[model samples]
Target chain A: MSPPLAPPGWSRWLVPPAALSVHLAIGQAYAWSVFKPPLEAALHLDGTQSALPFQLAIVMLGLSAAFGGTLVERKGPRWAMTVALVCFSSGFLISALGAWTEQYWLIVLGYGFVGGIGLGIGYISPVSTLIKWFPDRPGMATGIAIMGFGGGALIASPWSAQMLESFGADPTGIALAFLVHGLSYAVFMALGVFLVRVPRPADRAAAAGGPSAAEGVRVSARSAVRTPQFWCLWIVLCTNVTAGIGILEKAAPMITDFFADSSGPVSASAAAGFVALLSAANMAGRIGWSSTSDLIGRKNIYRVYLGVGALMYLTIALFGDSAKPLFVVCALVILSFYGGGFATIPAYLKDLFGTYQVGAIHGRLLTAWSTAGVLGPLIVNWIADRQEEAGRHGSSLYGLSFAIMIGLLVVGFVANEFVRPVHPRHHLPAPPKEAADVQRQQSA
Target chain B: MSSDSSPPRGTRNGLIAFAWVWVGAPLGYGLYELVRKATQLFTG
Candidate 1:
């Protein structure tokens, strides 16, 4: 059956809020840390044990996104958003049950596996539709939606913390928090599902002559994965993300370690402040850098992100402990690049491969994030632990990690330089009956 | 892009306002925390 398009009177601008509603709600994933300490104390689990739900959720996010990408493209945003709502909210409800029953593995299955699928699907649910709706400003359109992901934790952190504080951190309290989160997000995401509308072929045809012109080689997701350009970008995204996450995963502690020996040491509260600043920088950078991409072009903006990103890391590696403000400013800029990297990539995919299956392609590309999520934290934390064990103090503890980050950013910069337009051979040929059949089977 | 097939300006305006408020409520809350945290960081 053909999908319904926006009515003649529909406003394109409303689509962004539809996207943001889901992104903002699912972005609560980032706030999982707020529950960590409480879960550990209440459940009598170790830090690593308590972290299983979150870790598994990330793993599931990548896998589900990879497996579900084509389905999202085939099924449409409303269907994808509905599935995301069901899986995501139910994951929370199930986690609530798990918590109440004191079953750690159930929490892992509920929040990790089930909720992770919600995250993956919810994350990519709006990309292609948004590109179609605002083809003239794909970057800015996507930036607005993706920015909510970065900002999700900011709202969730305080809210979840307050819930835990008010309701008590015990299993019942945590379960109630989960229940509230699940139900509210379900309602929030439903708004997106209702508001989202697919662009009809007629609207697309009308758009072709104007700012929304289709001027690039369009590849199907299956063909896109086969192109060298996709892998190059994969390398670029992975390395850039790895470099940023190295600092992010350890932001609070890294700041304290850097300023430990200063005349006025950074207190724990101040360290938390540093984290909040990074979050703000991250959110700001998404909208700021992405909108700039629409002006300067995507490639140029990425050069700034990857190349200048390396320089920012070098600044910290050399002069980090020399001045606290320098450290803070450098960290903020690096974090902005991190956020920008994420917000820009969907638009970048649109630029390279066109909007045909950009959402599915994007879903596949997120595996890089899942990979970087592990590699980044592992590299930084492992090195930091070893340094501390060796009695290294202060800035030296992280100096090595920062230098390594510089090297990785430079590598990603080279990869970005090598990224070229997808070759014509990779483009999906004019749709034929047999080709449609093959495509259907492939997506199936 | 031309608005030949688009909604009226008033409807668009109302929608833009509603859309902003819908997403902005949560985002505004987040920004409020951001401001609070920034204040704590700089004041000390």
Candidate 2:
């Protein structure tokens, strides 16, 4: 289908909400933990078995975004949003059927494989459109949309908990809840599909007149992966995410363990609170730090994320057990940087590669997230397990992991320093008149 | 391509506000719930 082109004076402000509709719906993936306990009890499964759907979903999110990105670019935001809506909402319905029937693999296939494609496509569908709309404030524009992904769990967690409480956590109730989610999100995401529009070519050309246009260096996604700059960014993103996600994945347990030997032992309720606080920080950092990136530039902001983030880990490792308040503050800052890293990266890609196929490039870059998603938890959990085996307790169990995170951050910092503008040879040559005419006609 | 057929300024303004409210209301509720939960970190 031809992408919808905006008439002159369609307010740019409308785009963020359109983007949010899909993001908030797909972002519910993070709230999978709320279902874990119930699913386990219902299916008589272990933690790892219950976690398979979420893990597969995340892995598929990366793979689909990488493979489907060019298709999204060619098809436009409306097509992408519609596809996301169909897949995401239907995945929930299929999961509902699976729950009712007590078939485990069906749940994985639905929520993990199909729903994950929705997540991947929905995540990037708005990115290039927003960047195009708000060329003057690309960081803030994309940040607003991406922040919804981080904040989605805030809504889904409490809502899901309340539903489970009301409906009971049995297979029937789970099926009912999934059914509701499927129908409701289908309705919500339809708004985005209806509202999205691509900037007209004239508008795009006008926006490209800015100074940072890098003399019109429009790197295609295939070519973008070839540059040293992309790999450097890959390392930068992987390390930054690895550091933050390690603490995030283990927040409740890590906090409790940090103070296990102290005067103020953390209660279960307080650990839950700590996790909520980190979620707030993560959401806030997406809008806050990414907007700051608009003013200070992407590279300088990442220096803070990596450099200052590593220092926060060092402080937590050394003095965390003694001071609860200090530990919380350090962790909050680090989590914020984690979120900021995600929100800011698309703007960073726009800066380095220009906006040619930025959505596709951004899609490919998310492989770093998939990598860190596995690596972060594995590092923290594996090390903590080994330390437990060695008779370590409290803060000692996590000190080695914290130190390793510091090393990883240092590596990321060096990678960020190595990033330069893409070479001119990588830039796409200007399209021939017939091709440009066909593109414009298709968009029209 | 400015058009005389465009909606009036007030209509456009109303749309902008409505769109923000559609997304913002849910996000606000989520944040309020999160803060309510997060308070336990200090009080608990």
Candidate 3:
């Protein structure tokens, strides 16, 4: 169903919370790891087998967002949120069935494929609308919503762990946990579906008349992909994500490995704490740094994300495990930049291509994330594995991987430098009078 | 546009407050949980 246009004086402030509801629900995907060990034990599967659902979910997230983006833009946020709620909640229900029946493939099909589509659509659903509503502070507005996605795991992780602790991690308990998640999230996400409103044409026109309106080259998603600027952004996102996700994916193990020879080796619980700390940094960065981008400009902020991010890697590499506090601080800063990069990109796209099809454009850009999802873990894990085979231990095990990440950040830095405003040639022409009239009529 | 045709000022303010709280409470709980967990790194 198409969302109704906002009535006059409808507070734009209401939009972020509406956006957050869906984001917070879908963001539970990040906590998928909490289920991995239990799934492995229950199904008698290997680590790789247990990881399949999360991997496929990530892959599906990118593919569906890329394909369904135009549809989401066409249908509006209310419809998209409704669809996400249905898909996400049902996927969990289906997984519950699979767990109860001891069918691993069914769980994959349900959680990975169905739930992943929900993640994709839900992620971009409110982004363009937020940008439209808060023309003056697009970065901060979108950041607030996107931060919910990063922070979602903070809620889901502990909640899921507590549930498993209570439920015994057996198949019956797993099924019950999934059932609760599916039903509860359905109720929570319904709030967003009901609350979302598109800006009225009159309201948009009034906003456009203001100084900070995002008015410029109006590139369609179809045309945006053709521009050099888009590819540059693709590189920028991919590398930045790869660098941060590498450490993130390996955070616990990497920290333990780094400090193996120290005066006090990091215990498993402390390593878990480090991962939790990184999550905090990741969530905080999404809001804090993205709001900073609104003030400093998107391009300049990327310079910091890529440039200073590389320095953090260098510090970790040089100091190794000698200094625990230094290593932790550097890792926290790098994770923050990672979260900031995700939050700030929509505003960056708005600056370059305008908001005509920004959600769709943003959808296409997330293919970079999907690619990084694979590339990051592969680089870190493969290097660490080789180091182990070679009998290397302690901090030396990750030095080469750290160096490679520094190089990747440098590449992203160059890519950010290459970005420029989209050319006028790529801009969509103004709608003809008849078409405009018809649109106005439909909106009215 | 002026606030002329908008809902009553008190109604609008109340809705905004409710909406923020709806999302904020959960997020606050999550942050508190994370901070509690993160402290183990320093303490342990």
Say which candidate scores most in lDDT: 2
TM-score of every prediction relative to native? 0.93, 0.95, 0.94
Per-candidate DockQ values are 0.33, 0.48, 0.44
* lDDT tens readout by residue for model 2, A74-160: 998888999999989988999999999999888999899899889999999999999988777889999999999987888888888
Instruction: Tell me how large the interface RMSD of candidate 1 is.
Output: 5.1
Report chain A TM-scores, every model: 0.94, 0.95, 0.95
Residue A165 accuracy (lDDT) in model 3: 89
lDDT of 3 by residue, A1-444 (tens): 655578767877788999999999999999998999999999899998898888888888899889998899899998899889998998999999999999999899999999999999999999989988877788898899999999788889889999988987999999999999999999989878877888864555555443232454579999999999999999999999999998898899999998887788999889989999999899889999999998999999999999999999999999858889999999999999999999999999999988779999999999999999889999999999999999998888899999999999999999999998788899987557534643565465
Where is the poorest 10-residue window by lDDT in model 2 chain A?
A: A206-215
Ten consecutive residues with minimal summed lDDT in candidate 3 chain A? A208-217
Q: What lDDT tens digits, residue by residue, belong to model 1 across residues A35-117?
A: 89988987899988988888888898898888899999998888888888999999999999998998878888999999999
* Residue pairs with backbone overlap in model 2: none
Task: Give residue A225's error in model 2 in angstroms.
Answer: 0.5
Better of 1 and 3 by lDDT: 3
Rank ordering of all candidates by DockQ, starting from the highest = 2, 3, 1
